[model samples]
Every structure is written in structure tokens, then in C-alpha cells.
Target: MNVTIIGGGAWGTTLAQALTDNSHSVLIRDINEAFVEKINKRHIHPFFDIVIPTSIKATTDLDEALDFSEIIVLCVPTKAMRSVLVDINSKLTSKKLFINVSKGIEPETSKRVSEIVNEVIKKKYFGGYVVLSGPSHAEELILRKATALVAASVLKKNAKDVQELFANEKYLRVYTSDDVIGVETGGAIKNAIAIVSGVAFGLGLGENARAMLITRGIKEIVSIVVALGGKMETAYGLSGIGDLIVTASSMNSRNYQCGLRIGKGMGVEEAVGSLTQSVEGIRAIVAGYEIGKKYNLDLPIISAAYKVVNGQCSAKEALTSLLGRSLKEERYW
Candidate 1:
């Protein structure tokens, strides 16, 4: 199958390598001329040290990419989702399956990527929307390390189709889920928690505190998932708890790294600007805070994270605030 990936960043370049390994022809559309030339001319990923397959190609033209294949894999961030979809809709000539690899709720609407797709794409041109998310990171995927991800959609067939497209017996595995709401909610909500986990570690609070944050963090994730009409069980599955464990604990996560910088005394703007990648956790913090208010859910961690990231309080102050809350029974179920 021919696949067109719309972004040429780390994740986009990483997926291009995976697709080529599966013997699928890939065309990546990115706005950076040097990045596009590097891939097309040298067959090298701009962000990683690994060399890409000669079979993989990239271009700067969105129209050419939209016409290249029926399978459109979106690797861009949530902030760029709407503009990219509007461009695709203008040039869409046939029904297309959108496989979104980005995670995070839109700050303006707090809508998931699937919702944004439906709002922008024409119904006649929309075939399906599948969200691919999990504990997998781009850095590991580039090395063909063992990775598992969930392909979720309301349509089971769409989910399975994605599973077949990315799954393999070697280093990558894909699971299908009909709980799109649960998968997307879990994927988005975990970013906020990951930031808090980073802050905990930056403060030199040992593994005990990290474990506590993750354990309590699962409750916050479930609350948002249930409020969003997602299944409670899905919160414990790969896209939910699985994703949280990986993202919140690792240095590979951009969100965690951002929080670490903030905890170590860097300003939020400077901490975020230091990373070459998009820090989805910052926006996820804001979106999660708003969702909590809209649904009237008690999300202490998310609220504290919001305050820290927004400059309303220092990391230590936020930690103190969290600890000062009235003691309550542990209710994870």
C-alpha cells in the first residue's frame, strides 16, 4: 500500500521507516525544504541518525501527497490538525482513511483528533478515522525496538485495518479497540500526568513519590474517560494505563522532560522552548483543566499541574498544595 504521511518531524520520519520496512511505498509531505531534500536526496532522517530506505520519498506539496494514496497517516500535532485537514478536504477526490498518530485535545475546543477530523472533512470524502496510540515512542520505533500500540476507532474494521497496516511479528504489535473515546481520552489525559511525574523526579522526590503519582494519576485518567463517555475498562488497557506508565516515567517523553526543566527552576516558556519537539503536555494541562470544569470532575493533579504550567505557582508550591488537600479514601475503582 502507498502511504502519505503529512509531517516530516521525528514521529513522521520514524513512521516512514516502519512503513518502508513493511514494503509499503511512502510519501512524506513536509514544509521544510532542507528536511525534504535530506530525505529525498540522502535518504537520511533529519532528526535521527538512522538512514531511511531509498523507497521512501518526501515532498513539500500537500496536494501531491493527498493524491498519492488512500491511506493518510497524520503525524502532525493537534494544533496543526485543523489547518491540515482543511487543506486535505479542499483537494480530496475520494474516500480516505485517516490514521491519526498525534495525541492531545485541541486547546480551543478540547475536542479529540477524531472530532476535529469529522468537523473539517467532508462526509462523502471521509472513509474512516482511526487513532493510533500507546506507550510506543518515536525514538524506540526508529531502532525497531519492541513496541505495542492500540489502533482505536468506532468502526472495528477500521481499527483492524490499522492493526494490519502497522503490526508485525518482529518488533511492532498493534491491538484493535472499538472504544475510540476511551483510547483518545486516555492518550490525551496521560500527558498531563506525565508532566507532574517529571516535576516529582526533578524535585529529587524518590521513586516512592513517582509511584504514588502514577497510582493516583490513574484515577484522574479514569474520571475524564468516564465523563467523556469512554469505557472504564479501557482506562486500564494499553492506551490508558499502559501509555501513562511509559510516558510519565521515561526521559524519552517530551512532556516529562518539559516538566523536569520546570521543576529544576527553568521558566515554563523557556523549558518548553528548549525542546526541539512539541510539548503536548502543556496544552493537555490546559485542556484537561477545562474539561474538569465542564464536567465538574475532581482532578487535583490536573489542577495543580495547570497552576504550575501557567505560572500561577512554583513547582514546590503546587506540590504543597496537592499535599495539603483534605485526606480522602483511596478510590481507584
Candidate 2:
């Protein structure tokens, strides 16, 4: 199968290598001319200092990329999703299967990438939407390290199709799920929790604190998933607790790194600005706070993260607020 990947960034190029490894043709479309040239001429990752497969090609033209294949892999950030979808809609000529790889919810609207795709893309040109999310990071994935992911869609066939497209015997493994909401909710909420975990670590909190945050983070994720009309079991699966465990505990996660800086006395904005990559946790914090309010749910971790990001409280103050919450039954729905 031939696929066109939008946004030739870290994850995008990494997946391009995966596709080529599976004997599929891959074309990457990125706005950065230098990135395009690097991929096309040097066969190297734009952000990472690693060599990529020479079979992979890149272009700056969205129209050409849209016309290159029937399968479209979207790897851009959530903030750029709507504009890119609108651009694709204008030039889309036929039915296309959209595989969303970005993990985030829109700030005010709390819309997932799938929802944004449905709202922006014309129905006639839309084939299906599949979200591929899990504990896998692009840094590890580029090294062909062992990773597991879930391919989720309301359309089971679409999920299965993606399962086959990216799955391999040695390193990459994909499971299928019909619970799109659960998978998406898990993927987005984990980023926010990872930041809190970072804050815990940066404050010189021991492993016990990291464990507590992850356990509570799972509860928070489950509540949000249920509120969003997804299965509770999905929260414990690969995209939920599995993802949170990896993201919140690792230095490789940009979200965790951002929190580390904040815990070490840097301001939230400055910490976020210091990273070269997009920290989805900031947006996830805002969305989670709003979602908690909309559903009238108790989300202490998310609330603290929101306060820190919005400049209402210091990182340590946020931690204090979380610890100061009244004791209650450990019931997690």
C-alpha cells in the first residue's frame, strides 16, 4: 500500500520508515523546505540524529501528497489539525482513509482529532477515521525497539486495516479496538498526567510519589473516558494505564520534561518554550480542566496542572493543593 504522511516531523518520519519497512511506498509532506530536502536527499530524520530509509520521499505540496495515495496518515499537532484538514478538503479528489496519529483534545471545544476530522472533511471525500495510540514514542520507535499500540475506530474494518499496515513481527505490534472514544481519551489524558509525574520527580519526590501520581492518574483518565461515553475497560488497556506508565515515568517524554523544568523553578511557559517539540500536555491540562467542569467531576491532578500552566499557582503550590484535598473513599469509577 502507498501512503501519504502529513507533517514530516519526528513521529511522521518514523512511521514513514515503518511503512517502507513493510514494503509500502511512503510520501511525506511537510511545510519546512529544509525538512523535505533532508528527507528526500539525505534520508535522515529532521529532528533526530538518525539515518532513515532512502526509499522514503518527501514534498512540500499538499495537493501532490493528497493525490499520491488513498491512505492519509495525519501526524501534525492538534492545534494545526483543523487548518490542515481544511487544506486537504479543498484539494481532496477522492475517498481517503484518515489515520490520525496526533494525541490531543481541542482546548475550548474539547474535540478529539477524529471529531475535528469529521467536522472539517467533506463526507464524500471521507472514507474513515482511525486513531493509532499507545505507549510507543517516536524516539524508541525509530530504533525499531519493541512497542505495542492499539488501532481504534468505530469502523472495525478500518481498525483492522491499520493493524495490518503498521504491525510487524519483530518490533511493532498493534491490537484492534472498536472503542474510539476510550482510546482517544486515554491517549490525550495521559500527557497531562505525565507532566504531573514530572513535577513530582523534579521536586525530588521519590519513586513512591511517581507511583501514586500514576495510580491516581489512571483514575482521572477513567472518569474522563466514562464521561465521554467510552468503555471503562479501555482505560486499563494499552492506550490508558499502559501509556501513562511509560510517558509519566520517562525522561524521553516532552510533557514530563516540561514538568521537570517547572518543578526545578522554571515558569510553566518558559519550560514549555524551552522544548523544541510540541508539549501536548499543556493543551491537555486546559481541556481536562474544562471537561471536569462540564461533567461536574473531581479532577485534582488536572486542576493542579491547569493552575500551574495558567500562572495561578507555582508548581510546588499546585502540588500542595493536590495534597491538601480532603480525604475520601478511594472509589474510582
Give per-residue CA lDDT, model 2, range 1-333, as digits (tens): 899999999899999998899999999999999999999999899999799999999999998999999999999988898999999999988999999999999997999999999999999999999999999889999999999999999999999999999999989999999999999999999999999999888988989999999999999999999999999999999999999999998988999999899889888889999999889998999999999999998899999889888988888888888888899888877
TM for every model, in the order presented, reads 0.98, 0.99
Name the top lDDT candidate. Answer: 2
226 Cα displacement, candidate 1 (Å)? 0.9
Winner by TM-score: 2
Candidate 2 clashing pairs?
Answer: none
Candidate 1 lDDT (Cα, 0 to 1): 0.91
Candidate 2 wrongly placed segments (more than 4 Å): none
Give the Å shift of residue 21 in candidate 2.
0.7
Q: How many backbone clashes does candidate 1 have?
A: 0
